[model samples]
Target: MTDAVDRAPAHVAASAVLRVGGRELDLARRFAVMAIVNRTPDSFYDRGRTDALDAAVRAGAAAFEAGADLVDVGGVKFAPGPPVPVDEEIERVVPVVRELAPLGPVSVDTFHPEVAVAAIDAGASVVNDTTGIHDPRMADVVADSDAAIVVAHSLAAPRTQLPLPHYDDVVGEVAAFLRERVALAEEHGIPRERIVVDPGHDLNKNTLQTLELTRRLDELGDLGLPLLVALSNKDFVGESLGRDRDDRVAGSLAAAVYCALHGARIVRVHNVRESVDALRMVEAILGWRQPVRLRHNLRPEGNG
Candidate 1:
């Protein structure tokens, strides 16, 4: 059997650009940033607030102007803990979607099918499913709406408690899993051009597993779809650098920078300001995002 992990992802199977309102997410461009808009308290990134819709609106707009080509809004906040009810998720995210989708190309990060439908009705253009479409109804929602989807590979639960860490080869397992799900989505009527893959960083796998995935991140590009990296300031980033959650800004930017170099296109981070500046520097040095794809050496010659 050809292990999907051993194989490399060429491009995310996305052939067409995701047109959100007036913004065109041209995936052919090297990479882009999708600012995190958490309208819930329990998000793993611990971002924006659900109660304060107006403030959250401001945050979304600011992210758009701050070099964010897309804004991802999450109402249910999936972390390593209990899941919120579908009704609560809808109530929290729908209003934000209704308000922000008009403002920009907004994506809703959710797992519940009901929540997905509500978000779509509220004008969300994308559905980011971290579960890899475990719920059958999830595909139905996406199929009915015909929205762009992000199918990330996850295990155990959205929050972190697990039976135990288990993977023969961590990176290989994740890549294979995502590939299978991508196929599964196709089976369920979702076209290849509308999907993106994410190697779930902190949702299911342990710190070591995440590091392995990051080390071989380019492997995902073989899928031939535009890649999206949610390399925000998470617990694993802290574990690696011996830093705490509050101090993972540099680590988050470092992880995102690494992902970008490895062919991932969209980086999801909490500290948008820092991530933006770092990617700008990346564009300046690497020239990947430049008009000519600059090809400058971010590192000096012979540094290796």
Candidate 2:
């Protein structure tokens, strides 16, 4: 197998730290988990379970208590659905941001400049623009605030479906797109430390493409920015295991671990507690974090 460093472009070097939401994550030493809290009624996973203001607030708090490093509140579903006016989007997300901000770092998953600005004003520290900050104004919003931006690679606008996304080399193409987006972000005043990149997972690709991308995820480190992989209960996981959305947790965790071991520094996930435990175990095994307890097999007195 080719080494991860060997796979990376020799001309580029990976980033060592990620700065976001007044927090600095040492990418080389630890991984952070960003919990998903959707305020949309038609979210593919939870399906309105958290659309209510109270429910959304509770969910975000619980996720943080469960060891999530950050909470991502998204007002609109990522899938192609009816258009949600900007005002409604703000109304749905801002209050949640206001409530969650005091607890921990909050990320607003949006592509609209207006929504991003509102969320930032409401105390969000990150703008997760799945459209790769296609709107220059979105970049301005992040630049104007102390928040960071998550630039994701997608072939089409949100709510628009690509018939069949194709790429001669998915990893290379995605890397190229992210490099351009990252450069655009810098051009708009966002610094490299405050910018993160996402591979967009099943955003525009099919199962095969997504799997291939996962296989070569380490190549993306060449971009030298913190990598965020959102692999929570995605279509690729379900399809790969011949399971449904509700049954993809195991596969999701597997893929997330694989990505983290490769190059992912942050994982955006729906199953916060499980993902947290899984990643913590990985961290401990890699010696980034010490084991919570070393009683097991230490001696006969402490042995189970």
The Cα local distance difference test for each model comes to: 0.75, 0.89
* Model 2: per-residue Cα lDDT over 1-304, one tens digit each: 2343344323122667667767776766677999999998899899999999999999999999999999999999888878899999999999999999999999999999999988888899999999988788998889988899999999887789998898999999999999999999999999888999999999899999999999999888788888899989999999999999999999999998998888888999999999999999877766666788767756766445
Q: How many backbone clashes does candidate 2 have?
A: 0
Clashing pairs in 2: none
Q: How do the residues 98-162 of candidate 1 rate in per-residue lDDT, one tens digit apiece?
A: 88777677889888888888888889878899888878678877876658889888886555567
lDDT of 1: 0.75
TM per candidate: 0.85, 0.93
Worst 10 residues of 2 by lDDT: 4-13
